[model samples]
Target: MSSRNSHSVLDLQSLTREQVGRIFSIADGYAGSDVSRLATKGCGKTGALLFFEASTRTRLSFETACARLGVHPLRLDGKAGTSLEKGETLEDTVLNVAAMNPDFLVIRCGDDLDLAALSSQVSMPILNAGWGKKGHPTQALLDAYTVRKYLGTCEKQKILIVGDVRHSRVAASHFELAKVLGYEVALCGPAEFLPEKPSVPVFSSLQEGLSWATVAMALRVQLERHETSYSLKDYRAAYGFTVENLKKLSAKALIMHPGPINQGTEMDSEVLQDPRCKVLPQVTSGVLIRQALIQLNCLEETL
Candidate 1:
């Protein structure tokens, strides 16, 4: 069952199904327990946060998990005093951090940076916060955890991911990991925004997707990544989850988005407030799942 803890968490691909199951089990425990119980799980341990990209939820979530687990959080802002400003290579910056001997390092950088190469250089565990447009494995983990909370089990649950799939790290991660975690996955978006050949079903419209899904996850339109300007009305007509289209969703279906939501664009305001929306639960589960990741990856223990 591979009970050994992960040496480095670059992506979910390295984790066995049993390891993933154990992580979810631990996270489930944290979700049900009071925050006070997590205070000393990583007592005297330390975690270094190195973010080259701007982030809100991922940065704060990891820091929050560190506090709850008695792990000290040290952040190196890419803009300020970091050596990257002074032409010190990322390799040197990583080397300096690794020399300090922190228990583990958490990082988020642009898509251009090679996380695999960075991991090869560091002896301690390197937890990938977001590796550009390639993947956000932890986000995928919490997402699956959140879905299981609402749907009882992930096995064969229909998960329809809607929006800019090509440039979204979360969407990419979910598309791959959701299948690994046992779900029937599908993608919906303008042809430009989707993969050329998807392993799962590809729906032309959001309405068609919602009709078949138990969970509808909206990916934020990656305007920053797109070179071609898209008409908002045309986008809405084609793929947006307007109130009218949201009505097509089954009553048991859940809605989701990896934060910093573009309220009126991808989905309407009312749908954001809908009880069936699991967005906030996904956020909440992020903290708990990260807590489990920190304990398992940074601390030596037998689960």
Candidate 2:
């Protein structure tokens, strides 16, 4: 496996299906073990996690995964000094951090910024934590990992990703990866919420979409990214996965959300506790996949 500067994970679209499968192959072992098994593998190395957007699971889990691999984590949130607070450029600030010589850089590019350009200016490996509404490769990895963990495989599985397709990094990453990974994927939401030129089948009716899904993944309605006004009440009535509405899906259908869910908007609050809900498992999958990613990119030690 390539380490350091050579293996930057900017997005899933760049990786071959074999490369993605290898990541999960490494992750499978980590799932059965813990920090104690490989605690010192990444010792003497460091990783910088710089998020320009608000995050909870993605940031915290990457930090945890770094610890499990014995890689020291340096965190930077969306707080002061991360901005043009002193008129410094984003590239300049990132370059300054690269000078510190961390093993890799994990970054979340906000405001639709170009991560590829930023990565080109740096030498160390760059891991994209999330890139605005463009991509969330790791999230897609974990989500697929979660599905594989429960269902044995993701091949030929029908994943109906519903809501906010036009402005969801998760949805963007999932569909791009799905094409190569062999999962059948589609989109469901209001016309405005869906992409104008969709790569998959688009559905405006939630119940109809739910009927065909083996994995029902709901994306959060990103009001922060929306420029025009929309009605939450109308959104809930149309796209929301309520207790009554979800019964229309197959009992075997797995439910998921990327978190910070808008409860009554995209999904019912009670559904979070549903038996079929794989939300928490996705969190667990995040740690395993991330640990594997760190090990592959930062350490030369054999797994």
| lDDT (Cα atoms) of all candidates against the true structure | 0.84, 0.85
Model 2: ten consecutive residues of lowest lDDT: 1-10
* Tens digits of per-residue lDDT for model 1, 113-196: 787886777777888899988889899998899888988988889989988888888877876786577788899989988987
lDDT of each residue in 76-167, candidate 2, tens digit only: 88657665577777667788888898888999877556778866777778888998777899999999999988888999999999888898
Error of 2 at 289 (Å): 0.9
Using lDDT as the measure, the top candidate is 2
lDDT of 2: 0.85
Taking all chains together, each candidate's TM-score versus the true structure is 0.94, 0.94
